[model samples]
Target: MKLDFNLKLTQEQRLVMTQQMQLSVKMLQMSGFELQEYIGKEVEENPVLDAEYDTNSNLKEKNNEIDYKKFIEYLNFDNYSGKNYYRNEEETVSPFTFISNKKSLKDYLNEQIIEVNEGEYTKEICKYIVENLDNRGYLDNTVENICEEIEAKKDDVEYALKVVQSLEPDGIACGDLKECLKIQLNKKGIKDENLFGLIDDCLELLANNKLGEISKKLKIKKSEVQRYVDFIRTLEPKPARGFYTGENVKYIAPDAYIRKIDGEYHIIMNDDILPKLKISPLYKNIVSSENNDNDNDTADYVKKKINNAMFLIKSIQHRKSTIYRVLEQIIDLQRDYFDYGKEYLKPMTLKEISYRIDMHESTVSRAIRDKYIYTNKGIVKIKDLFTVGISSQAYGDDISTIKIKNKIKECIESEDKKKPLSDQKICDILKKEDMNISRRTVAKYREELGIKSSSKRKRF
Candidate 1:
């Protein structure tokens, strides 16, 4: 009944993202390493764009006919906030200088295999087993499955499995956690039958710290069971934990550094990680020359490239400025944390920082996304500074979720081993301290801290 199409002109306000604007947002969200790569790609693609890898290098005059001062003024490199953004007297070392080759786990095993006096057939099977081993160094396939897949005898496969397991990283190629623990214990010359029994049958009980159940099952005294369990706890759960598992480790490069000097904290932007952006003089001349109207194609091309280069440079500056402002505000807000330590870190939110800096909450989020900052203690993710507030009932103040998690960790750490504190008990303790949190919330925070339940944390 109302199927009429008509053109209506109504005025409304809406935010439309242009290409440059989208690029600005992307730049803001990029980590320090990511921004470096993005800028590198841009330098390769855009003829008008040039990048100086040396941060300490001064601007050299190129193409004598062009005005160097005017060109420098046009690029605004001198006034850019990203250049020597922090005026700290002490020189900071670059983290990238220490990058070296990392030996993978498989490579380490293969190297040890070369020294073994085994026949080629057995060695081939050993290699196959090594290849099949998961990142945790556990042999995923059974001997029967290996025999079926490789068309080898079960005996040969078992022998090969033994050979692979005997290599360095003592617990390698184990079928399960129990086998792994036994191999490590046997290698360490621990020949206690009770320990072997505990590994075989009481692993679940051991995990829950149920020494009494273990003692009852093994017909041993509770104190003796506790001693054995304590020794067994030192075993490596994952054999491949410290070795490279063929995955490239992505290193975090801090965008800025917060250091304490004299009596005040200072923010030092990491300008070395990024290459300095500059307009190529050749392209600049082409864009600046006025008498080239006859060749509209080349002029338009150069002008477009110049516009793109300028926009890219502007976006980078905006990204740096936004991140700097956000970090500056964080330094101000979390001054106590920097002055003292993590225990003094105040609860902060993106909305609070956004209001303080007169920017939208989303902008603040993007500004800190995938960004990291080096502090006096260590490198920390910028987002980690912003934690959701948990209201304190006693003083009517808010506590950071991070603080609650820390408190939970402390409670579990200092708890009596014989009678561990339950989640409800922890909640009650926190409540007594004026932190109003439910038992469920306590459990959630405990889990987030990678802690086990009270039953699992308990000892004999």
Candidate 2:
């Protein structure tokens, strides 16, 4: 091969993303909560950015307008009663009033230990057992191991285990699932031998709904086994299911609301949770001063800050408009779903919506990511509205797979318990309703819905 050095002029067009463009893309994907946190951090870093809460409902509609001077004058925070940095001191409310006083699982158990009239040594052992419990309220450590670790006798450890297990949840400190079931059963005064036998040995069979096998092994009538199964299903599998685990309860705020005004649906953007951003006039004044021509450093610094602040403000407005347009298209397409119920939910896709809105598919995807909307139906994620389409022969329009799955669930629920509908039977029923789906796809959707097979769902 021969090598030759040559240079040729070529013209080509290419697309590149600037840092501000990347930030705008990222801001579009952030949820309402995440965007608030991001804005809070940006306010701390950028001197020209000033964020203040806008409490007036009348002023919320003006957030999309890019008139910074007019917005600053209209969005004064002097009389604002909402949560913000610049709220009146007299209007501030104490935060401690909202603090949760509920005791955690361990704290709850310790309190019972303290109240018991047991010896101090035994109480200390009880505390150790409580500390060793898993989140499921089952003891993770063996009695022998506890005895060795705390230098206590095996009998004392066993007694302490009993004392801890006897606490309010009824199955706390249990060693295993069988023991937990037995403890809950005993607390409930259920003394059926068949129930105990099923819990002790046939839990796997019971879970799989193998009542016939259980009946054959336990030598009980199938009807009796069904009764025992029904009673066992009422028991709690996890003793700590409802107890607090020292984590904060997070609440979701919808990004927008669809309200029916004057018999017409309208999209209302939720601007309350977000801080209204504005550029500091001080920095703008500094940049516009002619005397600062000699102070290149100060002028450049002020100009850079002002540019960043303006970009941030524009990016926020773009995010709001993009989300609003995306949702407006969604509400138009899924109007029946919002007006009626989930049954009217139609199949939709990002590609279809992007085409209608004249934006890229990726931009549409980012607009709906982690975003939720409040409707007359309830709060639902915008992404959840985009369901896979299944061609329907009856309507001539594509139907949502969610609706098919819902129909299948209804068929199974209404079917006879002694003769549960098989996957093929469910498919045939859906076919009768003009939903043409194969048995395999029906089975797959059923599994996704956490439904068992016909054989496993059958009752004696």
Provide the clashing-pair count of each candidate structure: 0, 0
Each model's RMSD to truth, in Å? 7.5, 7.4
Best by TM-score: 2
Local distance difference test, candidate 2: 0.87
TM-score of each: 0.83, 0.87
Tell me the spans in candidate 2 whose CA falls farther than 4 Å from its real position.
Answer: 1-12, 55-100, 189-191
lDDT of 1 by residue, 1-460 (tens): 7898999999999999987788888888888888888888889999888888873344455564656676555344323235535522222433574597678888899988878999999999998999898989999888999899999998999998889988889899998999999999878888989999999999998877877889999999988998898888788889999987666657677888776779888887878789889888998788678878888799999889888989988888898899889988999999888877787778899989999999999999999999888776577888888878777766567888878888899898899988999999999999989888899999998988889998777666
Error of 2 at 6 (Å): 7.2
Candidate closest to the true structure, highest lDDT: 2
